[model samples]
Target: MDERVATALGEAFPERAVDRTFGVGPSWNGANETVGVAFADGERAFCKVAVAGDGSRIARELAVLRYLDAERSIAGPGVLAGDPDADLPYLVTAPAPGRELLGVWEDAGDDENAGEVEREALLRRVGATLATLHAKRFETHGEIVGTDRGGGLALDPAPWPDVLRATIERTREIGTSERLADHYDAAFDCVEATRGRLEGAPAALLHGDVAKPNLFVSDGDGSDPAVGPDGIVPIDWELAHVGDPARDLVRAEDQLLNGFDSEGPARYADALYKGYRDRAGGLPPGFAERRPIYEVVRMLGRSGFIDQWVTYLDEPLESLVDRADAELRARLDAV
Candidate 1:
C-alpha cells in the first residue's frame, strides 16, 4: 500500500477500516496508483490518485464522474468519497460493472461456446456506448462547451504538429536501430506531407485515449453486469476533450484490429464506420478519404514518442515501426 494513499483513505473514510489490497483489476486511465484494493468494511470500490505534479487531472476526472453519477445518463463508478488534501489527491468510487473488453476477448478466445458471439457483441456494445457519450450535450467544461460531437473540451490541437516534430527529433537523438531509423524517417515524411490535410479537419468531443484498455465491456456476466438499455460504458475522462472524431475512431480501430493482416484492418474499419454512421450522423464529409492520412500521422506521432521510452519497457520498437510503416503504406496507396 502506498503510505500516502493509505493515510488519505484512512482520513477520508475514518469510520471504515480501509485495507488496500495489492493486485490487478481495472482502472479508468493510468492515474490510479493502487490497483485492486478491498476495504476493511467490505466496501467494493476503486481508488485513483494523482501523483506529484497534476492533482488537477484527478480532480477533473472526479468532477466528470460526479456529473455522470448525478445525471445517471450512463453506468459509471459511483463516488464513495475522497480527499484532495492528502499527500496525493485521491477519490474512491464503487467499481463499475463489467470486465474490460480486452480481457473478455482473451478469455473468450479459449472459451468453447462464447468466442465469436461474445467478441462481436462486445464490439457492438462498444460502438453503441461511444455513440451515447458523443450524443450528450454539455453546458461547460474546463475551456469548452456544447456537444458538437467534434467541439467538446480537449487538449489544444494547435501545437500538435510542432509537438510531433519535436518528438520525432528527440527519438532520433536517442539511439534507434537502423530498421527503426528508416521507418521513423519515412513516417516523419508522411506526417509532414499530410499535415495540411489533417490540420483543417473538424474536431469533436473525443475520449482522448480510446484504446481497448480504457474501454469497459460486459457480456452480461459477473458482478458488473453488461450494460442493459445502454451499451458499453466509456470511462476515463482525463483526456476527454474536443478533438477530431476520426482520431477516436482510428484509435479504436487500431486496438480492434491489433496490427493484424490487411483483411482484419479493413473489416474492423468497415464495421466501425458502419456503426458510427448508424449511431451518429453520417461520417464527416470526406472522412473516408482523409482517415488513412489522419491515422498514419497520429500513429507516427504516438509511436515516435513511445520509441523514446523503449529503454524503460520491453516493447519492441520494430513492431511499432512496422505498424507505422504499414499505415504509411496504406496512406500512400489511398492517395
Candidate 2:
C-alpha cells in the first residue's frame, strides 16, 4: 500500500485493519488512485486519493460529491470519510451495487440485437440522470473553486464565449503534436467567428465526463424495489464544472454514443433526448443548430491524442487530420 493509503486507513478507521488494496477504476496518469479496501468487520469501501496535482481536482470532486449527497436525489456513493484538504487528499465511500455501464454494455458485444435493447434502456437512464444533474443550479459558468458559505460551489463565472475560447486554446496546446501544432490557430478563428451560438448560455452543473466507464448501474435493492428509471449513477467528478448545459449534454451525446463503436444507434440518442426533454421540459434554444459545432469541439479534444492510438488505425495520422479538418470546416460552415 502507498504511504498515503496506509496512513489514511489508520486515521480514518483505526479499529479496522487493511485487508487488501487493488487498483479499482480509471485514473489520470499520475493524478489520482482509486483503491478498494475491505475491512475486518466485513465492510467494504472505495477510496480515491490524489497522489499528484495541486489538490484542486480531487478537492473539486469532494465538494461536488458533498453537494450531491446534500441533494439526496441523485443515486451515487455517499461520502463516508474523506479529507480533500489533507496532504495526500483521499475520499472513502461505500460502493454502489451492480457495475460500470461499460461492463454492462459489453455483455451485448456478441449479440447485436441485445446491444441495441440494452443501450436504449441504458441511454434513457443516462438522460434522466443528466436531467437530475442539470437541475442543480449555479449562479454562473466557469471553474468551480470551492464551497461557498451558502452550501454551494464557489464559482468563478466567465462569459460563455471566453470560456469556450480558453478551453479550445488549451486543448490545442494540450494536443502537443508538432506536426499539427501550427494548424490549430484556425480552430481559434472558428470559435471566434462562431461565438454567437454560445452567447448568454445559462450555467448549470455538468458531469464533465459522461462516458460509459464513469457511469454506474445499480440494481436498486434499497427501499426502492425497482431499479427505476433513474438507476444510473455518474461517478468521477474530476472533470465536473459549471458550464452551459447544452454544451454538457451535447458532449455527453458525442461521448456516450461514440465511446465503444463509431456508429451507435439513433434510438439510443432518442431515448436520451426523451429522458432529458421530459425532465428539463425542452431542448435549449439553439441546440440543434449549435450541436454540430460542439461535436467538432469534442472531436478536437479527442484528436489531440490521436497519435497515441494511431497504431490501431489502418490510415496514417495525416489522414485522420484531413478528415477532421474537413469536418471542422463543415461544422463551421453550418454555424
Candidate 3:
C-alpha cells in the first residue's frame, strides 16, 4: 500500500482494520495514486491520494462527485470520506458498480463476447451517456474550482479559449516530460491562433478524459441493469469541467477508439458518433468546425506521455518518439 493511502485509510476509518489493498489498473496521471481497499469487516472502497501533496485534483474530484450526487441523475461512486485540504489529501469512495468498459471493448473481438456488434452497442451507449451529461448547460465556461454553497459547481469564470488552454496547462503539470517539451509550446500556439474560432462555444460539462478505462458498464448481459439511464457510468471526475460539448465528443471518440500505432476501425468511430447524434438531436453545435483544433490539442495525450506510450506499445523509445513527433506535427498542420 502507498504510505499516503495507508495514512488516508487510517484517517477515514479510524475504528476499522483493513484486510488488504490491491492495484486498480494503470493510470497515466503521475500526480495521484489510487488503490482498491478491502476492510476486515468486509466492506470495500477505493482510495486516491495525491502523491505530490498537491490537492487540486483531489479537490476537483471530490467537488465533482458531490455535485453529481446532488444534481445529476447518472450514477457515480458514492463518496465515503475525503478532505482535499488535509496534510495528505485523499478521497475515498465506494467502488463504482460494474466492470470496466476497457475490458469489454477489448474482448469484443473474441467469440464469447459477441464480437463487434456488442462493442458497437457499447460505444453507442458511451456516446449517449456523454450526451446526457453534456445536456446540463452552464452560462459561462471555467475551471471547476470547487462546489458552491447551493451544491452546484463553483466555477472560476474564463472565456472558453482560456479555459481550454488551462486544461492543457493542467495536463502538462500532471503528464509532460522534457522529451516533447516543444510540442506543448506548439499546442499553445495552435490554441492561441485559433482563439477566434473557439470563442462562444456551448458551455456544457465535459469529462475531460473519456478513455474507456474511466467508464463502467453493468455485469449484466443485457442493458437493462446498467448503472445509469444511458446504460453506462463514468468514474474519475478529476478532469471534469464546463466546456464545449464538441470538445468532449471529439476527445471521447479518440480515447474510445484510437490505438497507439493507428486509429482503430472507422466503423466503431461511426457508431460512437451515431450514438451521440441520436441523443443530442444531431452532433453538438460546431462539432465539425472545432474538431481540428481539438485534434491538435489531443496530440498532447501522445506527445506529453511518450515514455508511457513506449512502454504501453512495447516498442523502441526512438521509434515511438519519431512517430509521436510526426503525428503531432500532422495534427498542427491540419489546424
Candidate 4:
C-alpha cells in the first residue's frame, strides 16, 4: 500500500480501527488508487485516493455524488466521507447496491444463446439507467465545478466542442496521450472540423466513463436475477460532465459493446440501442448525424493506450500498433 492511502484511511476513519485493506479490482487510471477497507467491527467500505496529488478528480466526484444525492436522478453509492482539499485527498463510500456488471456478465457463461440473452437484458437495464441520468438537461454545456445551493450543478460554461476537447486533453496528463501523440493532434483537428455539428447537441449529465466495472446490477426482484427496479447503478462520477447526450450514448455503446478495432456483434449494439430508444422516445436528437465523428474521437482510447492493450491482449507490441494504426485510419476516414 502507498503511504498516501494509509494517511487517507486514517483521515477518513479517525475513530475506527482498520482491520485490513484489500484490492478492489483492476483499474487502469494512473491518477487514482482505490482499496476496499474492512474495519475492526466488521464494516466494509471503499476508499479512493488521488495518488497523483491532483485533487480535481476527487473534487469533481464529490460534487457529482452530492448532486446525485440531492437530485435523486439515479442511484449511486452514498458518499460516507470525502475531502478533495485534504493533503491526501480521499473519498470513502458505502458499498454499491449489487454485483458488478462485469462479474454478472461473465458469470452468465459462454453458451452463446443463453449468454447473449442474459447479457442483452443487462445491457437494456444499463441503457435505461443512462437515460435516467441524461434526463437532466442544461441549456449550455460546461465543466461541472461543484453543486449549487439548490442541488443543481454549478458549471463553468463553455461551448460543447471546447468541453469535449478538454476531456480529450486529459489523456495527455496521464501517459496515454504521450504514446500516440499524433492521434491527439488528429482528434483535435477532427473536433475542430465538426465543431458546427457538435455545437447544438443536447446538453445533459453524462457519465464520461461508462464501462462495465463502473456499473452495478441492482438486486431487483426474483424474476430477473440480473436487473432490479432501480436499474443499473453507476459509480465513479469523477468523469461525470455536462455534454451532448448523443455523445454520451455513442460512448456508452462503444464502451459496453465494442472491442479492439471497434468491432462487436451487431446484435449487442442493437439490444443496447433498443433499450435507450425505448426510454428516450428515440435516440438523442443528433445521434445519427454526429456518430461518425464521435467514433473518430473514440479511437483515442485505443491509440493512446496501445501499450496497455499489448499487455491486456497478450499480443506483441508491434502487432498491436499495426492493428491500432489501421483501425485509427479507418475511423478517421469514416469521419
Judged by lDDT, which candidate is best?
3
lDDT of 1: 0.56
TM-score of 2: 0.84
Inter-residue clash pairs, candidate 3:
none
Which digits, one per residue and each the tens of the lDDT, describe model 3 over residues 1-335?
A: 67788899989889889999999988888889999999998999999999988888888899988887877556678899998899999999998887899887777765844688898898888888888888888999999888899999899999999999999998898774668888888888998999998996899888888888899887553444226777577899998889999999888888888876488889889889888889888888888889999998888888888888887789998898898888887888888
- Lowest summed-lDDT stretch of 10 residues in model 4? 221-230
Models 1 onward score TM values of 0.69, 0.84, 0.95, 0.95
**RMSD per model, one decimal:** 6.3, 3.4, 2.1, 2.4
Where is model 1 more than 4 Å wrong at Cα? 25-34, 70-72, 82-87, 109-114, 137-203, 219-228, 260-268, 300-335
lDDT of 2 by residue, 1-335 (tens): 87878877777777778778877754323466788888866789988777763567667777887777666667567677877777777778777656889888878545888778877877877887788778766666787767778877777778777777666665664463545553456556666777777776777888777888788887653354223347877777867778778888888888788641264667888989888888778876577766766766676654565564365565688777776666656665766
Assess candidate 4 and give its TM-score to the true structure: 0.95
Using lDDT as the measure, what is the rank order of every candidate, best first? 3, 4, 2, 1
RMSD of 1: 6.3
lDDT of 1 at 286: 54
Clashes of each: 9, 0, 0, 1
| Shift of residue 184 alpha carbon in model 2, Å | 5.8
